[model samples]
Each structure stands twice: as structure tokens, then as C-alpha cells.
Target chain A: MNARRLAEEIFVPHRLVMIAVAIGLLVWAGMAMRWHWIPRYYDLALQGLWRTIWLLGLSCLFGFMLAVPLGLAQAAGPRILAAPARAFCTVIRGTPILLQLWLIYYGIGSLFPQFPWIRESELWPYLRQAWPYALLALTLSFAGYEGEVMRGAFKSVPGGQLEAARSMGMGRFAIFRRIWFPQALQRALPTLGGETVLQLKATPLVATITVIDIYAVSSRVRQDTFIIYEPLLLLALIYLVIAGALALAFKLLEQRFNRGMVG
Target chain B: MLDWLYALWPGLETSVGLLSLQPPGWGGNLLRGAVASLQIALGAFALGLVIGTFGALGKLHGGPVTRDLLSVYTVVVRAVPELILILILYYAGTDLLNQALQAMGRRPVEISGVVAGIAVLGIVQGAYATEVLRGAIQSVPRGQLEAARAYGMGSVQVLRRVTFPAMLPLALPGLSNLWLIATKDTALLAIVGFSELTLETRQAAGSTRAYFTFFLAAGAIYLTMTLVSARLFNWIEARYRRGQVRQ
Candidate 1:
């Protein structure tokens, strides 16, 4: 085992000196960088952070749920079902999410007003807002990427297990639920975590549509103060923390499923 | 007969005109944007590969301090979203450059958007590329390197003969993925006001108020790029994998 060597590689005097330099820079930034804008914008930043979390959480949940059906369609369904699912996945994955967001927000959002029923409907207010389109775009994009992952996961589940369940007189649906789905779910869980972080990184795109996510809050501060680096440096640091936390949460979830087993 | 069909869907004529390639139409602008996007992607990808080669070498062979610095660079770049990173690099890089110029008593010069776009996106791509290339290099069998050394080959000669050849087939898949990503990430530059495909689509959609038509067209252009790139990479990967045992 090269564990000792790795430890030595990481813990040398050179690394220590570098770490000291890093700490020094952090201290200088903390003391010297602009701090005056925090009090005025702290509340907005909080709200924006909450909005970002909401977008990431909701989109990922709904998207993964949608992905199951899509994956199933591709992995096992008839030609008719598989064709549309494949096309949908390809189209969504092929283009930038920014274009899709704009298409929904600017293109379809503008189309809604021409119809009297849409304007007069009870759900009109929520439909009129930008967040719904943002949510739809993010959810669809996540689903598109996850669907391909799930397809491989579903296919990787051993066929013999399904046959054994069938031999036990289980119905098709029961075999899928009890035998196939669980194995596939476990297989897919590892990739799903990284995908979720990707989904988190993508949440900032919704801000383009006027949904005030944390990235938007940073952009606002920059525009307001005409001070560029401070807000952006802070933004980068904040994202780093969130990304770390997200990765940790996923690792914990994986460990729970892992039952202390590791590779 | 055609008149009746046109009357049945009145919006069709308007859409056709708006999307047409003539003077009144904005198709030219969108085409220009697509060309610009392709240029930026190519430039950025080349720059990224250059940086990635050094980064991978530094990580594999450099001192602990160098490794730590490289780790920090990759970690920070990977942690933040591309959009935020683009903003920070675009603004801060220009700001710092001008400041340095002032200190040198030289006049401040504007960084062209194309050059800036390439530099920022290339740096971002380099981080991911470093990881990919490092993994590829590590996968190359150590025995081959030892044999090369036994043949009286120096480190550089061994790298040229045994290492890079072994690494290429392994690295091709990831490098191709990075290429696709570089192409797509050019769209993010639109957010920073770069005149890329997305911005042009938006402008076309806004001016004509035919949003659906223009966006759909732009999406088609992007889809074509993706499909074409996918096929091209598949061919390249196939060529590199020639005579290798199938996994």
C-alpha cells in the first residue's frame, strides 16, 4: 500500500509553505477586500441562495423521477415508445440549457398572452411568472442527462435475477418493482450524485430568466457598486462551499446505501 | 390553391419571411454567430490542450508545491459553475492587465472579445483537461516505461516513444468530450455579451417578435454542430483504437 507514500507526498515542507501562503492570501482578502456591501445585500443574498437551493432540489427530484420512465422506455419498451424518448433525450442534451431557457421564457412566454383562456385562467399568475419556465427548463435538462445514465443502469441489472423473480410466480410489475428496479437504482446511485452536482452547477442559468438566484445577487452587487473583483471572488468562494457541501451530502447518501461497504 | 393553404395558417408566411436569408431576415446574423462560436471553440480547445499538457506533466513530475498549486487551480475551477467563472475571469483578467499596464507607465489596451473569450474558456477547459490527461498518463503501463529506460532511452525519449503513444488511445475519449463541451460552453460566453449564437438568436427573436421561429432555427444549428462533432470524434477514436484489443 502506497498510503504512507501518499501521505508523504501530500505532507512535505513544500506543501506546508504553500498552505501558509494560501492562508496569508485568505487573511489579506478578508481584511482588505470590500466588506461594506454585505449588510445592504445580505438579505437579498440569503433569498437568492434559498431560491437557488429550491431550483436545484426541485428540478433534480422531478427530473430523476421523469428519467426512470424515460430510461425504461429506452431500455425495454417497444419501438414506438423508444423512438420518441430517444429523440427527446438527444434534442435536450444536444443544445445549451441557456438556449432552452430563452426559448421557453422569451418564446413560449410571449405566446401565452395572445390566448384569452391562458390570461383568464386561475393558474395564470404563476404561469405568468418566470420561475415556472426556469423550473421546466432545468427539470427537462436534468432529465435528459439522467435518462441516458439510467438507461445504462437499467440494462446492467442482471437478467437472471429478473428471470428468477418470474420463476417465483411474481407478476411482471412485481418482478420489476422487487427485483429489477432496486438493483438498477443501486447501480445508478453513484453516477447520480455527480450528476446532481452538475445539476447544482446548472441552477445559475435560471438567473438569466430573471429568477433571482445567488449568482444573480452577485451580479447585482457588481453592477450596483461598480466594484468587480470583490463580489466575484466572494461568489466563487460561496459556490465552492456549496459545491463541497453538495458533494458531502451525496457521499453520505451513498454511504447510507453502501452499508459501510466501499470500493 | 397555395393562397388557401397560406390563409389557413397566416403565421406561416410571417415566420418564413423572418427566417429567410435575405436582407430583412436575421439569418445572416445567426450564421455569423455560429461561425464565431466555432472559431472560439477551436481556439479555446487548442489553448486548453496546450495548458493541459503542462498541467498533467507538472502534476505527475513536479514538486509538492507545484502539485498543491495545480490541485488548487483544478479544484477551484471545477467547483464554480462555468457562467460565474467566465464572468470573474473576463472582468478580473482585463482589470488586472490594465493595472499592470498602468504600473509600467504604458497605455491601457482593450482586450478583444474573441481573444478574451478564448483565454477564459481555455483556462476553464484546461482544469478539466488536466484531470483527464493525468488519468490517461497514469493508465499507461509502467513496465513499458521501464523497458524504454532499459533501452537507454532518456525520459524525454521514453515519453515520446512509449508514453504518449500509449496514452493517446486512452485519452481520446475524454479529449473528445472536452471538445464537445468547449463547443457548447461557447454559448455561455453569450451571457457575458459575446456575439455568439445564443445572443444572435435572442436579437433575431427580439427584433422580429418571431421568437419561436428564430430560436428553433438556432437550436437546429447547435444540434447540427453536436451531431457532426459526435460523428467526427467517433471516427477519430476508432482510428486511434486500431489494432488494440477490444475491451
Candidate 2:
């Protein structure tokens, strides 16, 4: 009758069966003739997996680096700077990442011919490459979202702790370095981890802009071989594995950071 | 300044021309595409809302068999990429269904772009919606439900009159956010050759090679829709909060 008892009774056995059935179905699917399509293009699939890793890793690194400064500024800077940064966050958050990608890759690229300055600029060569454009768009978009998370984390650091550091003759930068940063990082990790996983899923959108990520390669393989589901199913499996690893790493990090909290 | 203006004018003119609603203009195409996109998104959202509400309810109160099945459905849909889902549904959904139906001695059926888009997006949205609805339902006060039971109200009566109303306030913000996501996701329907705004913009860009202008316009349109919806949601939130105060 109580909520806890009901939850335990209903959820425990159900979850076990769910896990078992999922694993059984996956193994059965793996062993079936349907998997023949995968072996024929094993090399391509591997290449696709490699590309997915590379893109997600580089994009996340770039995005995190951009996010930190932007977030800090948005939180602590003068209104003039913070207002625009806030607006940037709002606009980016409000729209679709797909349109952002298209705007940068095809939309901006198409302007090069008309803008003589852009055409002649040294950056044009780099901008012409699809990967850079995809990377740039992804970085900017993630920066907007992660900036908000970081701001929330920074704000969550207790005022009393900050004052204590200040009273100990710690300068603003030193106080931030020694106290604020670590605490904020710890508080922000879970949300950041979730966002990173979401970003990993978003890597496939780069395929639309012709980045040849895993999804692109899978589609190419499907097109070349006329095997529809196999390549996609394999790609989905690889994504699941990557997401599982990320989730595990985040859990470990959370546990390590969670020490001394309760006491 | 005049020279800069002159240089930009031609491309801008062409873009505006393309987006015009007049015959032989690309604006008409984009408008039609926007309508199709809206239809798919709205249809998907409606279906997803239904599935999500039921799924959340089932996960909360259903038997073990139902709970496990719903959880599996949610997890798989959440894990799989939206684009992959769209591709699978476009390519295999109708065929698989037709094969099963034929074995049942029913005629084979073709799934249209609209139907496929709605089905795929609905399934995907339903995954997130289940979480949203479940959280909202859980947030409703246990005391309220207990009070309803004290008054001899059955589960159905309590759900209809008390639980649903309380949950609506909590659920509206999340549902609006999901609606925006659904609208944006219809962009992926472009791969299936659905004549959504994104697809129309792509075609116009490809044909004219005025890609920058067209896409910028498309981006502006998308931003406008998002901004308007956000304001609308704010208004709804305020209205609901006022109603709560009166209650």
C-alpha cells in the first residue's frame, strides 16, 4: 500500500526480466543471418566507428573549453558583456542544431563567392572544409548549453565558503582557483556528463553536412550493398556501447567526487 | 556603403523572390513545406502525448509484464538516434507491417511520408514524454489522492478530476519544450524526402546556389517560431499560476 513497498514489488522483478529479454534479443539478433550484412563490411564499419570517436572527442573538448570562459563571463562580468552572452545562450538553446549546422556549412559557405573579402581571406580555405564547419557549429551550440550548466554550478558554491576564502587573504583569482573551480566542477559533473552523452548522439547530424561520421558511413554502406537494417543496427549497437562507457565513467567520477559529503 | 549594398542586393533579392508566396516563387514551396512540417510535428506530438501518458501511467501502476515492456520501449527509443529511427521507419516500417498483414491475408499497405514521419517522431517523442509525464504525475501530492479516496472517489474519478488538473500545471512547460523539439526534429524528415521547411530550403538552395540567403531566411523563420512559442508558453504558465492562486 505504501509507495516504497509498491515500487519494490512492481519494479524489481520487472527490471530483471526487462534486462534479460533485452540481452537475449540482442544476442539472437547478432547470431542471425541478418548479421551477414555486417561481416561483409566490417572494415567500413570499423572506419565509421573510428570517425565517430574522433568527432565526438574533438567536439566535446572544444565545446568544454569554449563553455568555461563564456560561462564565467556570463556569471561575473559586467552587464554589457553578460547580456549579449545570455542572449547568445537563449538563441542557441531556442533553435534546432540542425539549422545551425546548415547555416554554417551550406549557408555561410555559399556566401564566399559573393563576398570578395571572404573569398580572398586566408580563413576561406579552412572554412571550406566541412569538418571545421561542423566542429565550429557543434562547439558553439554546446558552449551555449554547457555555459548555463556551469553558471548554475558556479552559483551553487556557498557564499559562506567564498567569504571564508576571501577572509584568509586569498585574492579573487586565487579564491576562484582554489575553492570555486573545484566545487563548481564537482557539482556540474553530472549534468555535464549527461550533456556530453547527448552531444555524442548529436555527432550523427554532422553526417548531414557531409562529415562522414559513423552514421554517414553506415548510410553509405547501406546504399552500396542494399542491406538496409544491418549497418544501421550495428551503428546503433556501437552508439549504445559508447554511451554505456561514458555513463560508467561519469558514475565513477561522481562516486569519487561524492566523498566526505555526508559526514 | 552603397557599393556593399549593391553587392548584397542581388542575392538578397533572389532569396526574397524565392521565399515569395506568388506563383513561380519559392516562397510558396517553403510555406507549403512549413505546413507539412507542422502537420507531421503536431500529429506526432498528439500520438506521443497519448502513448506517453499511458506509458507513464502503466509504468507507475501496471502489472510486471506491462512495466517491463514499457521500460524496454522507452530505453530503446531513447538510446537510438532520431535520424536512425527516421531512416529505419522510412525504409522498413511499411514493408515489415505489410509482410505481417499479408500473412494474415490482409492487403499490403504503403506508408506515406506523412504517416512515416508521424510514426517515427511520435515513437521518439513518446520516450521523452513518458519521463516528463511520469515526473509530473509523481509530483502530484499524495495527500490529494488520499483525500479523494477518503471522499470515496475511485481511482478513475480521482485521476480525472484531481490528479490530471494538478499534473497539468507541472506538465505544460515540459510538453511545450517537447513540442519545440518535435518541430525542429521534423527537419530530419528531409532525408525521407518529406517536403518540410528544411527540405524545401535545401532544394531552393541547391537549385539557385543561393544557399546562404535561403538558409539564413530559414533560420530566421525557425527562430521566429521558437520565440513566439516561448512567449506563448510564458503566457500559459502565468495564466495557470493565476488560476492556481484562485483555487
Candidate 3:
């Protein structure tokens, strides 16, 4: 086929060109601001961005770790564990994450000082900080919502495959590892990507508790400079870059994992 | 022994550090806040339904430009932090409105916090709703439309009678999920000084120095709303699924 025809057949949009134009506009805006404004506030912005990444990364890591067991419990047949797990998921998923954050940061944080054991403990300092509470809230939020996604994925795995593995003299652990894990993870990948994006968005809520994430820095900048749109525009562009990168990364990872599977 | 009992009942309110949820106190404020939260959620959901319907229609049938424009809208809304979006919209919306008024030699007008809150939440929720509805509409079988057309039904008639009724069963589950999200998104409105549940709880907590009591009260109220809504949506889903064979 001719090059033009082949290009049409490939069904590629002008997305790369559009992305380039967006980046160019962002750079141009940055340079325009850098003459005086960005130089003065660059450190603050960078610090806030760093904190945002740290908050999101740690919460997502711990939350995903905690979510696996929660997800498993929901799918597990044993009523003893599953009932509580089900209730936990329902409560967490049902309520707003902001409410959860406030409940932890304000409600529990205030109550902590009253307990002599809690106050005297070595862990008291960490618990006293807003970041820890924010982390806890975000983690709980993730486990609640993402746990459901994973549970659904787990259920999607064909029972026949597990039965087949069992009949092959495979131990329960071996059967789960070989037959269930891969299929569930593969099924869960897309949903998990969306959840991670949401977790990233939720990172901004930490700022409400006075943790200086990117949104906090932008708010500070807006207040200090009294230039409402500039700081916000810059912050939005930064988020756009981060979100685009995340989406691209997830796409690549999905392709890598799905290799040799039916397209 | 009483101290130990107090520890178990931290917010019991019979003594120092006791939490209480009874009426004629913080409970009233918290419930009022819950009412405000529900109001905003309902308003936003209603607005989202309208925007989402048009958005889905545009994506499904409109020109390439409309599709690209809507794709950008969905992507940008989904990607951005909703809190940031609301803040930007709230501030910029006021500023622009004031500017326009100034140009017309009119007095500078303050945007109502409730209106701004509902508008921003509705706009954001609409993006997700669009995607949900688009998927739902697409899931309706093509044969149904063809069959309706064969009966000499017009496109609008088919859409009203056949297409809508068919898609509602598929769409209700997703729309209910969006409704839950809309309810939660209202909590973010508290950050902008909206007199919602979170803000009310904060005020009560700050003044009384009873952060634990008020926040916990607020959390319970929110949980009650969410759980009740979940049950309600499940009923609605069942109603929509009437006559359909279960899988």
C-alpha cells in the first residue's frame, strides 16, 4: 500500500502532533512567566509537586497492598471474614473520601492526645502529623473502591480453570498462583489503571488538611501573587502532563502484559 | 472504672470527652448539613443528566469536530483534580461575571455559593455521565432500532419509545454509580466555604473544640446518606429490570 493509504489503514489520529502543540504552549507560558514570577516561586512549586508525588505514591502502594487481602476476602467463601470485609467495603465506598479524611485527621487526631498510652508512645509524633492521617484516609479510600474492582476481576476468572488445575494434583496455593492470579490481574489491569488515576486526583484532598501538595502550592501562589488564573493555569498544565504520562504508561504496560493474547 | 468506660464510649457525652449525637445540639447542625449535601447532589445530578444526554448524543451522531471537542472535555475533566476544577471554575466564573457586569455599568454581583457549587459539580459529573451514557446507549441492540423503523416509527419516536426504555436497564447501574460519585463530590464543595455537611461539622467542631464529636457526627450522617442511596438505587435498578430475565 501507498504510505498515505497505510497511514489511513493504521487509524492513527494526530494525537502526537496535538500533544506536541500542547507541550509547546506550556513551555512558552513557562518561559513567559519565568522572566520574574516563576523564578521567585519555583522552589515552592517544586516542593509542592514533590509532596504530591510522595503522598500519592505511598498511599497507592500501601492501599494496593491492603486491597489484595480485602479483595480476596470478598471473594473467599468463608463467611466469617467475608461478612466484615463486605461491610468494610460498603461503608468506605459509600461515604465520601473527604469525610473519611476529616474523620481521621480531625476526629481521631484530636482524640489521640487524650489517651495516655497513645500520647506517650513513640508513634505519637507520626500520628500527630496531618500527613499520616491523610495517608491513612487515602489508603482506606483506595482499598475500599479498588478492592471492589479487584473482587469483580477475581470473580471473572473461570471456575473451570481452577477445577482443572486442582485435578492436575496442584496444591491450592499452586492452583491459585498458576491458574487464578494471572487471569485476574489481566482482567483487572484496565480498571486498576483508572483507579490509580483517581487515587492521584484524591492526593489534592490532603491539602485541605494543610498538607502542602501541588494544589496547596498553587493556592499559596494564587494568594501571594493575587494572580488567580496564572497559577491555576500552570498547575492545570502540570496535572495534564502527569495524567497523560500515566495513561501512556498504563497503555504500554497493558500491551506488554497482554502479549500473545487474542487481540 | 468510669474512666475505662469513657474510653470505650469516647463520644458518649455524659462526661468530659464524651461524644453525643442527640438532638438540640450538634446533631441538628449536622443533619442540616446533610440536607444541604443532598440538595447539591440532587441539583448536580439533574444538571449532569441533561449535559450527559446531549454529550452522549453529540459523540454518537455529531460531526468529527463535535466528537473531538467532547473527547477533550471528557479527558480534561477526568484527568484534572475535581477540587482544582471547582476552585478554578468558582473563582473564574465570579471574576468573569463581575467583569461583564462592570462593562455594562452594572454593580458587581457575587455568585451564589450554592449555584457555583452545583454548577461546578454538575459540569464535572457530566463528563463521567457522558461516558457512562454513551456506553449504555451503545449497548442497546441495533436490531431493536431497525425493528422500530420497520414499523414506520420516526427516529425521535423510536428514541423516545424503544431506544430509551431499552437502554434504561443497562444505564441505571452506571448512572447510579455516577449519582454516588456526585454525592461524594459535594463534600469537596465544603473546601470553598459552602455551608455543606463538612463545613458545618468543621464550624461546630472548631467553636466547641469538639472536633472528634462533630466530625464523627458528620461522618455518620454521610454514611447514612450513602447507604440509604445505595439501597434506593438497587430498588430503582430492580424496577428498571422488571420483565427482563435474570442471568
| lDDT score of residue A78 within candidate 2 | 83
Error of 1 at A105 (Å): 0.4
Q: Kindly report which residue stretches of model 1 are placed more than 4 angstroms away from their true locations once superposed.
A: A1-12, A260-263, B1-10
For model 3, how big is the CA root-mean-square deviation? 3.7
Candidates ranked, most accurate by TM-score first: 1, 3, 2
Number of clashes in every candidate structure?
Answer: 0, 2, 4
Per-residue lDDT for B232 in model 1?
92
lDDT of 3 by residue, A191-251 (tens): 8888888888888889989998889988887787777778887787788888888888889
Stretch of 10 with least lDDT, candidate 3 chain B: B13-22
Better of 1 and 2 by DockQ: 1
TM-score of 3: 0.90
**lDDT of all predictions:** 0.90, 0.83, 0.84
**Models ranked on DockQ:** 1, 3, 2
lDDT of 2: 0.83
Cα lDDT tens digits for candidate 2, A178-203: 99988988999999888888788778
Write the residue-wise lDDT of candidate 3 on B52-121 in tens digits. Answer: 9999999999876678779999999999999889988998899899999999999998888778988999
Stretches > 4 Å off in candidate 3: A1-35, A115-121, B1-11, B15-24
Which ranges in model 2 have alpha carbons more than 4 Å from their true place? Answer: A1-24, A111-128, B1-14, B104-107, B243-247
Name the better of 2 and 3 by TM-score.
Answer: 3
Cα lDDT tens digits, model 2, B1-247, are 3557658675555555667789767777777877898899899999999989999999999997887788768877776678887887677788789999999999988778898899999989998899899999999999999999999999999999999988988999999988888888988888667889998888987887777767777777777777888799888877777657554
